[model samples]
Target: MFRISPFIFILIFLTACTLPFNQPILTEGATVPRPQNAATAPVEEQTEPPTAIPDTQTQPTDIQNDTTNGATTDNLEELANTTPADRDQVALVEALTGNDLPEFARTEPLDVQVGDTETFWVSDILNDSNYEVDARLRYAGPHVLMYFETAVDDQIRQEDIDRAAQEFEERIYPRNRALFGEELSPGVDGDTRLTILNITLQGAGGYFSSADSVVQEVNRFSNEREMFVVGLNSFPVGESSYGSVLAHEFQHMIHWHEQRRGPAWFNEGLSTLAEDLNDFGDDNTTILHIQNPDIQLTTWSNNAAQTGQHYGTSQLFMRYVYEQYAQDGGLAQLIQDDAGNNLAAFATMAQQTRPDINSFADIVADWAVANLVNNPSIDDGRYAYSLLPETTTPVDLELNTINDINQFGADYLTLPTGTTTLTFDGSDTVSLTGATPNSGQYAWWSNRGDDSVSTLTRSFDLRDLTQATLQFSLWHEIEYNWDYGYVAVSTDSGETWTTLEGQTTTKEDPQGNNAGTYGLTGISGKPGIETDQGEVGQWIEEQMDLTPFVGQEIQVRFWLIQDDAYNANGMLIDDVRIPELDYVDDFEEADESWEGQGFVRTTGTLPQQWTLRLVKEVGSETIVESVETNEAGQANISVNDGETGVLVVVASTPYTTQTATYTIQSETR
Candidate 1:
């Protein structure tokens, strides 16, 4: 007689559209399985096919007579008796269901009330030590791209998947350190194990507090087990960008170990703060990258129905608090005070320590007014030509590793407390360089846009750039510590310039100190291609399309805004380049409708060659964006639901384009 294990059944059942969402529920007293030490190692290749044939010699004699459900009276007896053997088997099953248990020292079973909360204990069907370790590392290894054979519905792409994983790691890493201090190490105990599985899009992740249902979902499977599985043809980012997501998830594992529950703000905010890009030395000075609260902050504040208020606002608010308390080592104090507090108490503490905490809405308004304004220091007279709009000091450009040192100088950048410098050996290829602890600074370009005319000596061009990349190294002092300056660029040769994304930053907020250095720095320069653009956030290596500007005279300018009146601390910029494009555009224009009262279609054949951009003017941050057009020449966009905004339309062809505008209502919902 042949018998199939539950694990294989689970993998096959959940592969299609619907995943099992219902299962036996429990509260506490469930036994989760302990993991082995060897699980964290790299997975060795499996040369043999994964199949098991039952040991016929060990089979029970009555198996043929009671083959139904593959259970005999003896088997039923063991389950009913709760004997040691039976209990052990049960424990294994529970363990398999929940993936792995947290470390023993930090967690102990407690009597949970049925009405208040539910618990899961699935230890009955444990993956044998060898099996779990062997499969886990193989699936989770950094080099291997773990994905599904056939794509899942709305499945995330490899780039997005890698980014998601990296972002998760970034948020998790620092929280673990701050929460556990120095005691936390990933993959040390069975507690930190992760299960990446190939569940359908709807059932991929676990619920807020549904461990029991998760157990049942895990149990209803057979064939091929992955602690974590990619469903149908998934790939990871290239080796060059591997660690971000892994670090993120690992941090979650660490946080999950703690038995205490805190508010979502504290849990996620700290996680956002704790996310590190892994580029710092012992001395704590950054080498290449700095933390970006903007991503976390911005995403959190988008209040549309689909907008998430937790991460973005929390990250920004936490950053604000960190800036206020960082100097006095008040970060730990603030976190501790807010840890167990209820929402009101937490809000009170936040108000007292940082800003008022009416809600994320208030925070977004304040942030936009204070930081998003177009406060460029340079005026019209400052550029190489009189035609360009004025900009602030601090010129922006794309800088590469080699060219940065020469242009920005070595003094501007700092090595973390214990980080080493990158080096290029005789072979002429760059390697991660090592060095003693150090911090440095640079005094690069300032935007002449805000200054009196400076004659152009030469204009930056990208005609020779093919198969090359553009990157920039930049930094912002802790919030309000704005002693430093920044850089900007003009693709139109300084006639008119746009603020480089992430051109400026407020100091670190009071609650946290500076986020340590990171890799994956950004460029202050805009891409040569009009379609390929850059925005505010961490540094990036974006490709440029030099095709449009080839042989066309291009102007470039840099700025150095040194006004410390508003912020005493300084900013830094280094490196520049023009890189080749890696991806082609799949330009799909969506059908769009505006629900606002004042925004209706105008008559005039909709001017064929006009630029229609969605401009969201939030305080100082006015984002002027052009919408993609369809074959019918229709474009679509929407503003923040409650905020009134104007959509700017310009017709530049046939003659010098004239501008028109339409206002958006606060909310239609």
Candidate 2:
């Protein structure tokens, strides 16, 4: 929970909103202070890595998932830092970074030696900024300069300072750079010596200010000099936690030079892991995440529960990634990924390190399962926690407690103890993560409910077609190698099932927690055409071949399956229609009612014109069309196996007012 953000408090409290520090372990190092008041949401999101606003995004917050601008840009920094419950200084810096005003015109900070007195601007977090710290450079290491506030007479013990200084210079400094690379060498300060100012901060253990990373031009509170801030009173001087806190903050300094605008979850995750690599540790916080595994993986909020969960989730994930992927130095490649991203960067790293996976959700899925059983012997260790010991509390789930999981969040659901395979009674998982729809005014989104399935089903008569293909537009990010969104055909009147393969389908062992048992719908330990990995951030056209079943009466059903843990933004099904696949059904809850009367026929002449689907406000001039549906209230769309055609739709004057009125009007020309 060390990574707190100012905006998270604003979003969590509807208006607005750290920990105490610890001593150092000169041997292995101590853990960081329990970062209190971190901004996080039980609502779950990494965009909520996964920012698709719904159609009616009129409000600033859409309850659990969507976090929009509740206030104006002018009030952003103010609101973000105004929450009484959260005086997180780190968040204040995040707010300033978003304004994009300050330019990094290095002020050429004075290079001082050990025993030189200097003053730097420090944020008075409790009082909304403003403070001056007169600190004397106490230790000059080969790689860093440590300073202590001089105002407190005899406050810091000399030996404690010496121990802390020695650790930073001799231990923490070298290990951090060797593992995670350097912290802006000769950075904005134009020197390899990163200024570490130990001042009395308000409520933060410590922070690396992006504002200070740049020279203060438009902003005055900036030290104008490059320095990282750590609280003096928060931690005992000689404490080993210094290694962790300093290492954590140092990573932030390194990241600042990359993407100034980045996801707090990812940034904090890497830094939290930095603590571990520095010999300091996470204080066994993974249990917190294991207990409440449903928090959104990529979002930050200001609160006690979410803050703790975010840190625990992120650190555990990073630990998993580093341990599993670092063996071949792929972890460094992951570090070099686009810093401004969330799951996408992890996805890119996965493609390179583990060829079997292709989505960040894939790693998350494995991590989720591994959290339950931290055994390296299981499934070739693809789903166990090697970062932390296997000694953890057992998972206890209250029935029917799992529901409506958000983007990049995860939930663990258990079937009856003796259950071998998972079959939804009628429930589901799928969610929308982007704003622009694939093709209509709206698309169907399935919330990624754990151990659930979102389905779209209807009877299809493919007896007459020589060649048939079920085509649709979809955007999906499912936990790869573990979860899937697939299409299954039932020819026996809703009795048997066969997974249909499409352009986006792939096969993998989805048995993380469900190992040695059946998990996905059709395939047990084998491969099937499923929405496994890969993050299609936007909607893309895809097709399911139905030509093989051309001479049969089968019920075609679109499905999305989630295992016992890990979630991402659900699938967005836009234009395919078993009578409009947009009418998605949470298969675990109810059967979908896709009401429409249509037949697929192959006639080269009549079917030459492509079908146009129009979603327009009644009597309004704006008509969102799949084809050219502009003039008359008619759409001529007929498709065969030949050349593609366009559908033209024309609206009438019956739709004149725009007061939240919508109509799906399509006619044959």
Candidate 3:
């Protein structure tokens, strides 16, 4: 006796379709005599021959004695009892009434011979076998044959079949054909039929079974080979999900026949594309690709860890390429091209669509850039879509108070005893003199406490300056035995310092001898060192030449130091100055001789540090050429070539800014 094992049960659920007879559904957990060739038999052996039963035949009352030709109903009870209870009753009804069976099943069974093979009725084998009938339904237009272990009427209705057929014909088929530019063929037996079996599909919505010869058969009606069989989950799934799965599997079938096979990424990517193309929109599973762009396209693995990203990125890449370069029938061309393999197919498509892009590497690079900088206004045709607007410009720095010290990138520190502050002392103010009014705020009293120190440090660029100077007003009260003050400068941005000569001082004691480490190395001076002890005395003007630091960037620091013994009122500093040279150029005079001279002057009373640059404006971009000034703040810039150009002379320092533009013509002296 022929027997269907559990594995075959699953295989049948994947590929079996309705013919013109009632197929005997194998029992769920029944032991029967296994066929001699059960292990080695081909798929055809598992499928019984077609059956024929007349419509006039009523439901049989006596099951045991009912026999027709070599077929007997003796095992009906055994078949019913062995199958699942829900399916057992339905199988018994099909066996008895033959009402819901196909029209072809109503005819007498025929032994049609084709190529020396005899075709027997499927019912003939059922009568002699111990299997039972489950549920079955026939759907025509997308030619679906649905089977389930539950009753057919209970599990699926004709309307469900109609909906499936309508979706496949109206949406899935047209979209897939349009994408691939190829006609879908029937299976090996000349039938474009889809056997949609209801089974427990683990971790999937549905699957296409390619191993079945029936699926691979040639369709006699369309005269094309069948694609494959579809297996759907037995549980209820919404029409949208069903439609998406149908389209997805159909794309797989189309791809299978088009190129035999390709890389998993391409295969899955195209199928996902088909799903969205069918108007199902992208499901949650595929959107992950865009969310995670780090995954490489070609190296996407289909395992559990990467399944979502792999599918998503693949679809994204394919869609990106399609929208950007292959709006024409390039994707279809890619599908049909016989490039031997997936990479070769891609290469061929890339070559035909974008000859400039050499390989997938270049495509990936451009794709990554598009994902990152998706600004269309500045895109220059690189990105396909714009994602964000332009970024905001940074605010310019302003000089206001000592708190605005940040403008010059300077820092003030009062260690162990005092805090740096900007305040006016009653007797002294820098603004009353030559200092800018905003610069009148003096560096007030430092720590009078023992072992205290105070510092004011700032850095400036003097690369283009011919001359510079540091000058300030100071008042101090220091005990001759313990405290002093000084000024220092560093060329290497304050990593080290060199104190200027004649800048340090200390008050004298009653004996008229300076006892502290005053006027030592690395010390500038104590300004009011001659004042009486404990007196915040007269302010003194001080100057330090900065010409040595010209043409170099440097930092200057002010220091107030106190010894471990007695400390008097500390120090006060105002009108601290690092003069930057300002440029005054006579372009008209220079143009007459192809030479321009500019004078740099101190913005205040002291010489300053400044940079001079000649900028040529070409379209929207400005190119800077450095110009050096002489000790007299004179910059003689020559434009030798005889061409009209827009030139800008810009001079800037940590303390001042000036700009001059000239529209000069080429003229000989």
RMSD of each: 31.1, 25.1, 41.3
Residue 653 displacement (Å), model 2: 39
Which tens-of-lDDT digit does each residue in 1-669 have in candidate 1? 000112222342334123221111111001111121011122222323212311111111110111112111112122112111111112332221223533222232222221222111211121211111111111232322233323242344556555545543454344445543322222221233233432221111111111211222222211111122221211133422233223323333333334122333344444344433232101111101112211222111111111122333344444444443332254444444433222233345446645634433233223322222223331211111111112112222112232211100111111111222211111111100001001121112111111011111125455554322223343222112111222223455344432222212222211111111010111122111110021212222222223444444444322322110011111222333343423221111211321111111111111222233343444555454444444333444544433333333222111001122222112222
So what's the TM-score on candidate 1?
A: 0.26
Better of 2 and 3 by lDDT: 2
Model 3 weakest 10-residue run by lDDT: 30-39
Q: How high is each candidate's TM-score?
A: 0.26, 0.50, 0.37
Q: Rate the local accuracy (lDDT) of all candidates.
A: 0.25, 0.46, 0.37
lDDT of 3 at 58: 20
550: Cα error in model 1, Å: 90
Question: Order the candidates by lDDT, highest first — what do you get?
Answer: 2, 3, 1
User: Which of 1 and 3 is ahead in lDDT?
Assistant: 3
Write the number of the candidate with greater TM-score, choosing between 2 and 3. Answer: 2
Worst 10-residue lDDT window for candidate 2 reads: 599-608
The C-alpha local distance difference test score for the whole of candidate 3 amounts to 0.37
